[model samples]
Target chain A: MNEVSKPIPVADAETAPYWDGCREGRLLIQQCADCRRRRFPPHRLCPHCHSANADWVEATGRGKVYSWIVVNHPVPKEVYREEVPYVVALIELEEGVRMVSNIVGCDPHDVAADMPVSVFFEPADGGMVLPRFRPATGAA
Target chain B: MYGLRDKYAIAGVGETAYTRNSGVPVLDLAVEACLNAARDAGVDVKDVDGIVSYNFGDSAPAIAVATALGIPNVGYAVDFAGGGNAANLITLSAAAAMEAGLAKKVLCFRAMNGRSGFRLGGGREMLARGVTQHTAPFGWITYPQAMAMWARRHIVKYGTSAEEFGSVAVTFRENASLNERAMQRAPITMDDYLASRFIVEPFRMLDICLESDGACAVLMTDAARAKDMAKKPVYIMGGAYGGGPDQGEDLFDAIRWPDHSENYAAYIADDLWKSAGVGPRDVDVAQIYDCFTYSVLMQLEGFGFAKPGEAGAYCASGAIRRDGELPLNTHGGLLSEAYIHGFNHVVEAVRQLRGECGPRQVEGAEIALTTAGAMTCGSAMVLRN
Candidate 1:
């Protein structure tokens, strides 16, 4: 694995493992051990049952674009100053969790709400393979 | 609603002046707001046992204010949400903290000299903020600019007008003239609103919320003790703070109907109404969030006052006018009163219910509903006599 790029801001202790999966080219979400409920954007405890007992579950990374906006403005310099208008979208994983990720490999206009898409990671200028998303169709 | 209603009321409310780069510190604004709210409530500093605030400007452990003011032992503590969200959060927390045997007398506050204290500019500094970096860099820069995209879609879908939008500004300015705390009390006409320069295409400069240094507070004790207190006991009938975390298909897509407050305001109203077992019918007045006039229009639909696409007409009918069937923004609201986030809305609701407003007050207001929108979180509360 390449060197880790940006440090996780809000993620801590219990959320570490989920971030770890991203480095390994895997999308891991949280699943409550007791309630059989799945959670996204990793947290320390299960929000459904407030149970601390949970496990990291690998996700299929395929879902629909719930809502999105085409960003034409210059990006924040700290993140990236590229002036490219990219589609920033919230992807709802098939496993029933929504995570915000940049939609890559398509024109900004091509993206739409509820459009099927799948997760794909790419190498960044830095060492990390940034987790992004691409349009997809239902298939095996 | 009558007995002890005028006893332990809001005797005083204070705030630091808001400016783009007001050199004054943010903490100073919070202290000012706290002091003003106490004055509005007519309570002494030492009498405040509970400390509650929506976390925006102040740090956690707000006892610092208590310590600074020589009032020791802030028995209650809270820091939740950002933006004007703290309005309901502080109130609900203070009310419950008092009800659940946490603290007897509580102070609920939100203060931020956002523009001056930190200069809420849209660049690198914004990236460090919670979700400011998320949509901001991608062309959705300012809060109103982000909402403007949806506003355009609404105009297209429903055929709303610039004139209609201006009416909201006019009404707010009219009411705010009576609010000594408001930054802009000058009269504005639809001609002026329509003529104002545009900030985000369809949205003009007036469409955006002011960036100011201001604070607001509310004091609470259980209904039992409130009866013996100084002012009218504006009873908390119901309250809720919640929103959707769902990211379904199209989660990333900008809204078609464009309920910008999909997560917070709508649900806050629904849940609060459900919990109180009362609908909008029970409300005599509404202190809806007015970060933008569109927000008020959107909330009117969200809170069940009007149907979607009908807010333009509802507002145009002067329904939300100060003398309409259901008065709104009686204290001028954020649009004119002061952008104390949404905290000022709650304070005004209490004022109207108590019939405390001299000229701007809504006559004989009994039940009032106040709502707010956090980034995506929202909260609302119902107050009754």
Candidate 2:
């Protein structure tokens, strides 16, 4: 595989805390204070109740594979050409929120829908750490 | 109530030759298409007073096209800031303008050198924005990969197979063989579709749309003035645009969208049929936006042509062929024809309604349906001759 670095996540004002949580090896999601609904990719207001008041809560990091794709054609070839056929999936957390992440620790072809997965952190470009998912084990 | 139905008509449609390299400025293509549309309608260019176009910052502005066309005075002009989803909306906006007495002879068009310049599939830095910020770090950087995830969800939920998706590609290619304007006219079978390399899991190269350089334009006016035009007018029966619940301002926000298998079509289908005063069974032909083969399947289910989880079988059963019950993509769609940002689909629908598609024509096709975009926010319209 090529040694080139991958694109790091650029955190904006709304998503800074989520990245902060990832840097600390915690999976954080926003929960609306009004309706008690949780959401991902941190936003300004609750999509459900339109409340601007929300707080970041540490998640269980346990999710199921809702959907996934094995990308064979990689763009930004320098960064991903060596990672062809990597599995990228939408993980539906136990809290009922979905987010995008990589399905590691298993064969890309073996990944299936509803497969239970748990999150782990990995170092990325520029000292940034990203949250990825792998098949869940009995522990946590 | 339903006031826009049959109130305005597309009097003429025009398209430049679909090519990988137009070798001209986008403005030139826009002007060429506008002139061709005016000529097709027998409407003097000097009398054209309004313009509408859409792009992702890759096309000429409406005012620039108007300046090129030399319209003495522009009564109304606007450009939507989007891609394929804006195709039908531009026409709808133009028709609404005419209905509101804001302008007459409004020309709606889309022009792009998609192959030679600013390719949708190419590696561009701007694509890594918004929701992509969360996914791009994991090598999920392009549209096909994101859409493939949705396609995979459909497969898991509905038992959709690769062969079934391939059937859509095969059918459109068959239709394209009869279309001289199509970019990939050489016929391909289901075997060829299966053999094509995968771009992403559940999506082969054949299943994806062509990246083409082209332009398409349609002229709209009041129904009264349409009767005097050079060609038979295709009335704008009804249409709807925008997103539904769970669809945020960002594109492909599948994380918040409740069902990955469902598309924007489901939310708007009822309104589309209700306003058109016609059911899915009444459509004689359909030009479904086929940015990807699975998109066609999703729209088929979304538009009520087939029940959810049944579009795969419906397509594989030869139901979308020209001789089938619901002739679809008669001009080969974006898959085999060319991608003019779905504007070409509108042009083909107008031609089919006018009986101008000599070889690929649906015999006596009176009513047609055309959809734009998939996954994200979308739009659709019904047309009648």
Candidate 3:
């Protein structure tokens, strides 16, 4: 994949911590202080309990492939042309929130629904890091 | 309750020739379509007091189109935000304006050089904006990829085979073959669909909608006034728009959307049927949005035409074919017809009701349903002659 031309994510105040966690090789997600529920794409208010109180808690960084697609069409950039046939998946995290990421370290055809996976941070353009997933080790 | 039922009517519908490149400014396409609608309705352009349109920052604004068409003294005008999701709502808003005595004749249009100018196809710069910023870094940056994820989930959950999804493409292609205005009018078989290259896994090239440069317009007025129009009036029976919980989130944000299998149709189906005083079975034809083939399956189930998870089997049964129980996308839909971003679907519905679709016209068609947008917040309308 052409990592040099790949777009890097810009973080706002609400999402800065999550990116910060990625840079430090940790996965962070917002946990509602009142409902004790976890949410991705950090926000101030809890959607479940409508609570403004929340905390950035470390995640297990493990999940199952809920669904995925092998992208053959290079979109948003011609740089992705070489990256065609990459697996972009929705990972249902252990904490009960789902996220968009790539399933690396495996053949695109090998990824399947309910396949257990774990997260790893990868450096990107600029000083940003991205959380991507791969097949879990020693797990069903 | 149901006060708008048959109160306003679509007196005329018009369109520029569906093409890959119009070779004209977006305003010219808009004016041509608006004037054609006025000619079709036999109404003077100056009489159109209200103008409404919707776009994703791609089309000529309603006021600009009004000025170009020389429609004097526009009393009410609105340019709705978003894309196909606002297709039905824009027409409904015009009807609302008519009902409130804000305007006499309203013109609703969608004009864009979707192919030649600002394409809906995502670009590198677009990836840096809004929610896409989060997904772009991972190479998740296009509508087909996002929708394919949902299609994958539906297939896994329901065992909906890829062949069943191809059935929609084949059937719509057959319909398009009869439509001279369709961009993809060649007949395609299920084999053609399956053999097509995958834009995203679970979504082949045939499964995605065409991007064409075109425009469509519809004229709306009170039923009493429509009685004197040139063409048969297709009454606005009823409709619904908006979404359920977490619908405000971006289409790719499946994190907050509780059910990937269900779309906004499920949430608004009850209101749509109740207000129309008709069930799904009562409709003779439908123009379900076909941003992707799987979306047609999801809507078939959500709108009560098929049971949950059975829409695949329903399509495979040839129910959406021209002579089938519920003929769909008689003008070939966005999949085959020019994608005017679902506004053309509304045009097809109006034409079907008026018996103007020539060879592809549904037999004995009186009622038709048209839906816009597949995921996130969307809209649907029920119309009849």
True contacts kept of each: 0.04, 0.70, 0.71
Error of 3 at B107 (Å): 0.8
- lDDT per residue for candidate 1 within B158-206, as digits (tens), equals 6777777777788888888887767788989888888887654466778
Cα interface RMSD of each candidate: 7.2, 3.5, 3.2
Candidate 1 at B152: error in angstroms?
6.1
Docking class of 2: medium
For model 3, residues A37-107, the per-residue Cα lDDT tens digits are 88877888987888999999998999999889999888844578788889998889999888889998999
Q: Judged by lDDT against the true structure, how good is candidate 2?
A: 0.89
The residue-level lDDT of candidate 3 at B267 comes to: 87
Better of 1 and 2 by DockQ: 2
CA lDDT of each candidate? 0.66, 0.89, 0.88
Itemize residue pairs with steric clashes in candidate 3.
Answer: A76-B124
Off by over 4 Å in 3: A1-4, B124-129
Better of 1 and 3 by lDDT: 3
DockQ of each: 0.10, 0.56, 0.58
- Screening candidate 2 with a backbone cut-off below 3 angstroms (N, C-alpha, C), the clashing residue pairs are none
Reference A-B contact fraction recovered by candidate 1: 0.04
